[model samples]
Target: MSTTAAPAGSQIAEITSSDASLRRFLAGLPGVDQVGAEARVATLATRSIKTSAKAFALDLAIRMIDLTTLEGQDTPGKVRALCAKAAHPDPADPTCPPVAAICVYPDLVPVAKDALTGSPVHLASVATAFPSGRSSLDVKVRETADAVAAGADEIDMVIDRGAFLAGGYSEVFEEIVAIKRACVSPSGGPNAHLKVILETGELVTYDNVRRASWLAMLAGADFIKTSTGKVSPAATLPVTLVMLEAVRDFREATGRQVGVKPAGGIRTAKDAIRYLVLVNETAGEDWLDPDWFRFGASSLLNDLLMQRTKLRTGRYAGPDYFTLD
Candidate 1:
């Protein structure tokens, strides 16, 4: 629930004033040891929680979920159903906590907004040419502004991977800044939170992932996300560790805290618990809250629900017990 002011324009200008300066700053970032990172997460995955602790971890994971459904065939009926599920993840158990948010395409913002109204569950819309990040800046910004106008509580924008990989760091940086501006509501109320998707699968290396994480944070992204869920090898544990380290160190250096979301390929209660362990081990206990961490998956919620039922009722629920949105 706490908020940190964006870095001053002067501070951003010093590092991003030109392509050469931005390149130098990114180059100065320490390299990531792939083996060490993989080994650390592998070890952490083995640490098991006891009965009581497992129960708590399961609930925490439920609260951290950004229940998402993004598909070309999506319709109002489906989105509304997803919204209902997000607000009350387990209808049979009133004690179950709602998910953190509901993420959908920009065109369906109004449907999700109407469905999620009067609930604490947030409404997130993916913009800036989601999953591909190949569009004009003007178009991207306009889409973002339109989503905000349509009652989106958060904007999940994709970074220009082509520009970033081609060493056009300034181009990617400025796009994020422009989209951040578009998140501000025209009514001048609180700005919609911005979650910048790095799409790490296409970045190709741990060092590049580290650099992109920093660039997104510098450009005023409220949260740095791992993937768009459309790419292969999305949200690997090693990539997430590198991102967690970047956010932890960036806060120390700039005094501004940013959130991390690893979307795609993470399913089941076991996978969720391992990620919670990673956040605790790498970023400390502060990021354990739902505000700082999130899982962007549609099927992950069903698994979490089944696990919770097993823990509470001493038996596993049938897969058909829950609706498949």
Candidate 2:
């Protein structure tokens, strides 16, 4: 499907001008078929790639990783090491592609920036009371600005699920818009890309996932992410399928193309490839690159490395061969 030009600013504004309009628009969205979605992902999961194609997929999967580390104990040294690993995933193999970006807590953005300076791997910071978007709007906005000022190429912000579930759609929408504005550099340079996390596990249903996806895109999110990796039942194939469908339809309506990222609980090479296939099948080949899709994972890189080694050398490498994330 081809993407047409986006509607004028006035038309976009009318849709989100008030809570009633936002609700009416969101309610009008087509409901998701839970069984059909689950069935589709189940069928897609069984399709296997072989030999040369598998190699390509492994490398591509490696390139799509965000290489994240967001724990309370994360130190500058840890952030630097993660950045180093992101720059050169498998140091012994020069052919191994670097990850798409390095995701860290906002406080560690400076450390990561220093480590990843001159590297192609983008630096991402989780802001806006990340993993739990339960803070004052002022605090969230300030945190987003701070991360951007400190050198974050991307900001992964969590939407207030409490407000969303309480039917405060306008509150969540306005909050996202405010944070999107905060992404701009103080000097008026390029804005840091915004990835709005739906935290799908908390969202409770596939229908809600679709609504939240549309809500985020409408509010100017560059990417609609599945989870923060903190919640249970994170980033399942069926959930990702719903999000992929939202983005595909979104692009058709708005000229702008949005991205999809399935974070948390996605660890194995097989799991990562399954997500790649899901994106290819649901969102089309337009999103096959790292620019349009990503896997927010940490241990996932090591697994992809091990699988890549097995494919190239005809044997599996021990986990010890790669650095721990």
Candidate 3:
């Protein structure tokens, strides 16, 4: 994908009305043109991504992990060290389990990749001017391409909220399409996976969330993410439910599988569990894999360890090891 600026007035993803119901719904709503941010989303994400014995045993288990310690120096050595810790914890907890992927910023993709050399933990980098998609298209694409070239196994790019809110669906669609093309991995075994963040905090209503969720999926998003964690109104169970429903609907319509990521403020084990339940109930068994579902959290790892340590050993592990991702 060439790094080019956006064409003025170009619409993003195309919305199709299969029937009267959908057409009426789209016609009645004031989409990107009439949205306003009011109440902030206060839903805190906890380590609730656990499953029942049967669900854990029978269904594919995906653990969402975070390296929430982004505050310190983001040097390569530090990143590599942290990645090593993520792959092989200082103290292994059988109950804590293994995370499917390790998420970090674009600058740290290589660090994470190097740190997780032989482990199954995929390196995921946040792209598209993450936490905010207001940068030039060229810059965004360069960031994504660089991250992938640096060895990121997955690319988590935030969508252009401004374009989406302005009813510019084509802009959003084209951006994702280009970014996905840019995500080719180092060896080219596979391009980095794309997870489009809608910043559901910005997409207020359930109807709009559902519509945008489907739009991102159609635009070639491997995963539909909830928020960027930078916004106050981040991921919420209710909003996430709407997103999962959208994915389910999209699956029914196109027979394609897509993923969902609920990021921002997911703190404890309980919160993660709730999201897992919603995904399990709404999207069925197909959406249960780490490849399809992820929790973009920075703090949940520690809480889960603490909980697991308490449960298994009847002692709480000190919080010194957990860092904010």
For lDDT, the strongest prediction is 1
> What tens-digit string does per-residue lDDT give for candidate 3 at 1-325?
0111211122222233233332343444333212221111122233233335423521222255544344336677767766765665534543344676777778777667767888877888888887778898899999998988888878889889888887776677678878988987657588778988888888776667867776677668998988878887898877776667667766665667788888888887666666666677667778877777887776676676665555556677778755544
Candidate 1, residue 322: CA error in Å? 0.5
lDDT of each: 0.91, 0.91, 0.68
Model 2 misplacement above 4 A: 1-10
Output the better candidate (1/2) by lDDT.
Answer: 1
lDDT of 1 by residue, 276-296 (tens): 999999988999998899999
RMSD of each: 3.5, 2.4, 7.8
Model 2: per-residue Cα lDDT over 1-325, one tens digit each: 2222333445678888788888988887777778888888899999899999999999999999999999999999999999989999989999999999999999999999999989999999999998789899999999999999999979999999999999889999999999999999887778899999999999998889988998999999999999999999899999999888888887877678999999999999999889989999888999999999999998999889999999899898899988887
> Which candidate, 2 or 3, has the higher lDDT?
2
Assess every candidate by TM-score: 0.96, 0.96, 0.79
Error of 2 at 181 (Å): 0.3
Order the numbered candidates by lDDT, best leading.
1, 2, 3
Report the error of model 2 at residue 214, Å.
Answer: 0.6
Q: Alpha-carbon error at 120 in model 3, in Å?
A: 1.0
Which is better, 1 or 3, measured by TM-score? 1
